[model samples]
Target: MEDSVFSLIRTKYNTLSPTQKNVADYILSNSEKVILLSIGELAQFCDTSETTVIRFLRKLKYDSYQVFRVKIAQELSGETTDSIYEEIGTDDDIADIKRKVIQLTISSINDLNNLLDEKQLAFFTEAIVSGGKAIFIGVGSSGIIAADAYHKFLRLGIDASFSSDSHIMSIACAHARKQDLVVAFSHSGESRDILESVELAKEGGAKIAAITSYPNSSLSKSSDIVLLSSSRETKYRSDAMISRIIQLVIIDTLYVSTVLKLGSEGIKRLHKSRLAVAKKKT
Candidate 1:
């Protein structure tokens, strides 16, 4: 089998340029050898320039071409679909656990590209771009993703902050208004504290957006928009593991979308923010 690397690219075929399309065509058909191809080798094989290969990778949202190759190799290892998430039994071996986590996280992210809705993504992004103040709420694992997201928005000069503590989120909701945005991050979508704060913000007329697994859960029901993600099932539900990785992927997607909407101004703000802190790096 060629693995999903072929189907994934073909799904986005029309969007690729002439050069990138050629590269995609070659890769999709030759996915087996793609694992061993470097960026230059790939470009040569496709009769395109290295720059074209990189641009193709950028369109796929990969940080670097190397990571893209690694993902392809992982996919070919035969664990993308079933058996991606293995049960952590009482006597699970270290090697098996490592492979399970690696395959599961990759599979989770790949599934997100399909699970997320384009219209909903655009609607919330439009809201954020239209001067909507945002407050992100999450606890424990979700909290870390929210915090990182908060930092990204802060650097881009967006009016947003992350609140993990129940008390702080409640306080923030008290002051929230109709035009503000309340983002609830929960994998299970059943957090009592998150639901309570979401309800409070909803009463204040804030535009609520939720990033959670269950679309019919309280957090989802209370929110004006829900950005759904597929949470992998495991023996025990824990933090800083598989689901957190999916949450972060969602966060990065939103951050990139926001940056694209903000355009040049967002880039300048990010550069300036980095500069302000760069002096402290000594």
Candidate 2:
């Protein structure tokens, strides 16, 4: 099934320019009305020009305003899930908290499906499979994700390295070669250290892939490939909480895809690794 227009708008909202955001805000709030209005009328309602509206639609990859409106109309006609962000209340009990967390997590995962481009995912998987070495870098919570990715790749017998320290990351990236792939994780995609390391990797002719929430971020701009995650932050829940889950899922997806592409060789290596780890057990 095609993604809901509302979901797409919310996922790509952070990447929109100010004028584009104005167009998005109007369509989101007035989705039903938007389907009825002409593109020029919608532009007028948002206090923007036809060209601005066209640009906004283009950003969403809508072929034309008519197609964009049809999608909204179709979504409006269907049974829609209310996935709006709800803040956790101080008075909420354990059951309430559990339900809210699970609901939001599920909603965010659904958004990830809607926002992620399959072609980009395939490209990233191919890069990992073909690259001579893989280096993962992130800071803070993102660093934890990088470490997890490194662990997964190691199990698959891929030559991979990960470092949370900025200096170590910089040094590692300095040695990156043309056949290397540097995977950087960041929710905001504006981490200074991550960007610095990415720059070094670029200088050394390494390919950069960013798994981040913001598509318009500096990291995304520098990346040879980008895999986007979608989630909403609330008063109590930070972007890390839900986005971490999504990032891990993305990593797992890539790992599995790489294994599939590697065929029997991949299975044999995975089996050997498992037996080696089992030998360490009591």
Candidate 3:
């Protein structure tokens, strides 16, 4: 597969230096013009030195400015000019805030096309479908995503469990078997409790899958499979908040794929689950 320049930028954005970030910001905001600009011109436009621009390219793992431009040009060849994210200001009206929020949400979700690795996603789906048992763990807002995944899996009649409590998570991990799959959700992927729980799961001989934003995070390091989520933070909106939505979308994708893989049996389980719930309605 070809490299995605924008996805690479977002993946490494948090780790870039201040000057490198400046170059990144300019390239992200003016991608069209960036591909057409010379290295010296881009440095001047970003108010940084040519050395800084070269350093930024290196961070993205491009050997030369020409290669970097070629990748960006390839990515932009079939793309439309859409605002990826916008900062919400105190002076903005409710309508302005609503528009910005929707745009940001759509753009972030679209970025998943580039951010997600299809092979990793297939690994996760197959793990939960055939691994026999699955445990979902997360904290704070990520806990919500874990719980949602647990619910979806349960409706599919998969033996799944979830807990937001660190103590219960630890206990669950301790009991994880080789056939068990442990799915951990953490946007930053650095949550101490999550890392500890994953470590325990690893020791117990379970397959670890991490859904997170940072590829270099500790949790990703320990996992057998990692699914990356794309998000950008602003004054009013944090990466965690934005990543929550993206995480849910990933969960939905997994759920649907699991159902298709399970065939008729999966549909029956879903139908039965819905019927059981409908019996409780007044």
Candidate 4:
């Protein structure tokens, strides 16, 4: 599903131009007043022209400013979740930072647990159990996640590859078959290279699953199923921070589910793999 107008504005604010951001900032900070503010009035408040204000509305996927204001007003009618990380200030002492971090992690994880749809999850799990190769694709921090998935799923006796490099991902997709599974991870779901590879693998007849924060993004659109990850980390630290823990948790869930589906045979595979790794430790 597409995000709400308020969410779209918050998520895309950084991509907006300076003038457009001016309008965004005002609307975000003054949502209640926007319900009564005219186009000219909002423009004056943003210190931008009326035309720019209209463009900002259009950017939010609203055809007009009035519609945009109405959406915000409607959202105001319901309660919204507060950002769990709001209390974690940069200037806090070490102990305070640690406490806030733990508190936020517990709250965000609980929220994510409640938000996940069982039907959507089952679709992806069944795909993995259907006897095909699985390819994991991600970049940067998400690459670490994809790599971790590679280790976990491979232990279940599935044919899996973790491709972090863009070129390698494209190559993997090039060789992907109809039964192959391509799972892409990108928090923004807007990573150009990842999107390109996913699109290619999709065309090549691979079933795709997207794990991301945004459900309506391009990557999600390409996937056969989506596993949404919800996080509330600080803006700059989102990709590399506690969100990664949530993602890992998602992978762990998938791992255990697949193991259960594979049943007794899956345990044997895991034991064998564990023994091989144990030999290395010796």
Q: TM-score: which candidate is best?
A: 3
Candidate 4 stretches with Cα past 4 Å from truth are 1-85, 233-236
User: What would the TM-score be for candidate 3 when compared with the true structure?
Assistant: 0.87
Query: Candidate 2, which segments miss by more than 4 Å at Cα?
Result: 18-78, 82-85, 89-93
User: TM-scores of the models, in the given order?
Assistant: 0.69, 0.81, 0.87, 0.70
lDDT of each: 0.77, 0.87, 0.87, 0.78
> What's model 1's TM-score?
0.69
Residue-by-residue lDDT tens digits, candidate 4, 33-71? 888989999888888899998788777667877667777
- Model 1 misplaced stretches (Cα beyond 4 Å): 1-85, 236-240
Clash number for candidate 4:
0
Residue 207 of model 1 has an lDDT of: 90
The sequence of per-residue lDDT tens digits that candidate 3 reaches over residues 90-140 is: 999999999988887877787788778899989998899885689999999
Q: After superposition, how far is residue 220 of candidate 4 from its true place, in Å?
A: 0.9
Q: Write the per-residue lDDT of candidate 2 for residues 1-282, one digit (tens) a residue.
A: 777777787787777889998898788667778888998899999999999999888888887889888877877787475324455789999898888888778778888877788999899888888948999999999999999999998888888999999999999999999999999999999999999999999999999999999888899999999998886656678766889999999999889998998899889889988998997899
